[model samples]
Target: MNKQIIDHLFEFWEQIGKHGNFLTKENGFSFAKPTNGSWPNKVFDLTMEKLDIHALCEEIISEELPNSIAVPENEAIKDLLRSKGLRATSKIKAMTLDTTNIFFGNIDASEFIKVGSPTEAELFAQVATESFGYPVDPSTIGALVDKPGFQIFLGNHENAFPSCGMVYLDQNGVSGIHMIGTKAGYRGLGLGKKMTQFLVNQSIENQSKEVYLVASQAGERIYTKMGFTTHGVLESYSLSLH
Candidate 1:
């Protein structure tokens, strides 16, 4: 529950969330980053001069996405890419956002979930695998927590076992969620719902007007039930270096 950890985790999620694989040079800065494939080709002209950003984008798309992907481009962009000896392909990044009705009713703050310290690596890994659909190693999850501003919250049942659903709070006024699953063999219970409501209430209390996350297919319904409308999807892509 350290404020510093909460701030750092938020910053890290922002940098990697919108930019995906692009490296950040500045510190303590946040911006409304353009999602994948939404950039104007002129951005390439400006960004590619020093960074092989276009190539990196291409590589990311090929490696991560192979179906229904097209990186948008204009004739000028095509020429620019061709001149650089790189071929161009157009693609779309699914982006969704809703601001009209984004709030969930307040719940009892006393019933809040308990957030453990940064050392709970195994617990973090389990959530990552089940909720986020990521095969994160325990060490990797721990390292992420070890980062300066990563704050994670865990929900427990009678202090015996984790009920699944951990919230990652960041400093960017955006709270992200991961590992939000009901415990195996405990499905159909309302544990997942309560945990989500707790986090949303907490995020709003912290002054975050909007919540964002990359939801899995199965978990999308849960988020929708919690009043989080789809903001948009960034079609992920990855290409080989060869």
Candidate 2:
């Protein structure tokens, strides 16, 4: 349970909700919902007690918004999700890279541009959606622009954004790389790898001593070759409410 990456995720949700959205933590239940009714209407922090899982599930089923719960690899939690007709839509691993004695060769970062404007954030969101097949709202991207301890980047492709990634430095000096993606037309070009390394390089430059990421199965292989080792696994039980 030494995983700070999961904690960072909750913080990530909290930050997103603070910007023209909603975030609430009370009565052993934490909620984050976006105004656009897009992805990541979450009920996380399962360690909290007194949470009426049944009632919550019933509410979600009754609503018309998409919802997902961050379920850990616990049989009890899985059983509860199954009882509510929830399905495992995705699984991710928390991988870590010790920055000590790491190599940072000459990095040509001329193609990477840090997101600074609302327009750029929109393009970043578009690339992310194409890369992951999930619609990432530009509002969320816009909120994080210029936010402290968080940095977003896009791969400049002849004045277009074909790839993108983000890095967040937590209070513990652990930087997390998130949402690394390349547009569909831009795949098979090693852009993912380059985007990842660029984010890592940026994290190291930010003076972080460690780096971690929540990686899907497809991304796990890419990080493994980069010397990242799995520290924990997270299962997300999704409900297609809409």
Candidate 3:
């Protein structure tokens, strides 16, 4: 498979896979997306050889993930890319682990989950702003909330509302812990550590093969304590949507 297409597919997956509609327009382009959740990270790999863009698009939509919309702009580019033979795919890997000798406590996630949506991108963003301290807009958070495997665990109190952490399940049967944080007042009580383990245990209960995540430098040690082993790293590249 094309690495570029796979990378785009992984981005789409990370964004909830609903964004597939965005790539269907004539000007929009993608290489490969996931079919039914196997190796979800594979969706982000870019192959070296360039295939017929239009034919590739058709093949991707027709075979890989057929939910693609029918738009004039997408059709035109499909034809053009097919002629150019410049196929792009992203390179990435899947992470996994076995559920043996794991240490964690009950998730108790639903206790703090007051507002739950199948995929509430708006609220997800609001909670992230307070949790991450970076004032992220809904548009940016919406992309993540829409991804295939996204779940939010939050804790709220008077004058303080923070998202405890976020977890997702990929097509590869590996669960991922994206971001985990607690409000200033809620720190030092082990909330951050527990939430991380909660998601890991949850994945194991669901029969997931492994759990993976791109952790911040400081957060790496937290995952390490929870029986998570790090073998390698994953990086991101963009082509300037402008």
Candidate number achieving the greatest TM-score relative to the actual structure: 2
For model 2, how big is the CA root-mean-square deviation? Answer: 2.2
Write model 1 residue lDDT over 1-242, tens digit each, in one string.
22222233335445433333332232222222222422110121122335454554554456431222222223443455456455533332221223335455654545444444445656755654565443545544444443433445556555634454444456555555544565664557676677666666655655655544556556667666655555433322223346
What would the per-residue lDDT of candidate 3 be over residues 68-128, giving only the tens digit for each residue? 3111113344344445442322223323345666646555654456225534545655666
Q: In lDDT terms, how accurate is model 1?
A: 0.44
In candidate 2, position 88 carries an lDDT of: 92
lDDT of each: 0.44, 0.79, 0.48
Per-residue CA lDDT of model 2 for 1-242, tens digit only, reads 43477887777677766664577765656777775665457777775357676777776787632377786667787887787778898788988888787755755799899999999989888888888887788888898899888899998767777999999887677788888888888789888888888888998898887887888887888899998888788877876566
Looking at model 2, report the run of 10 residues with the lowest lDDT sum.
64-73
lDDT of 1 at 85: 50
Colliding residue pairs in candidate 2: none
What candidate 3 gets wrong by more than 4 Å, as runs, is 1-44, 51-97, 106-110, 118-121, 133-149, 156-160, 237-242
**Model 1, 11: alpha-carbon shift in Å?**
4.5
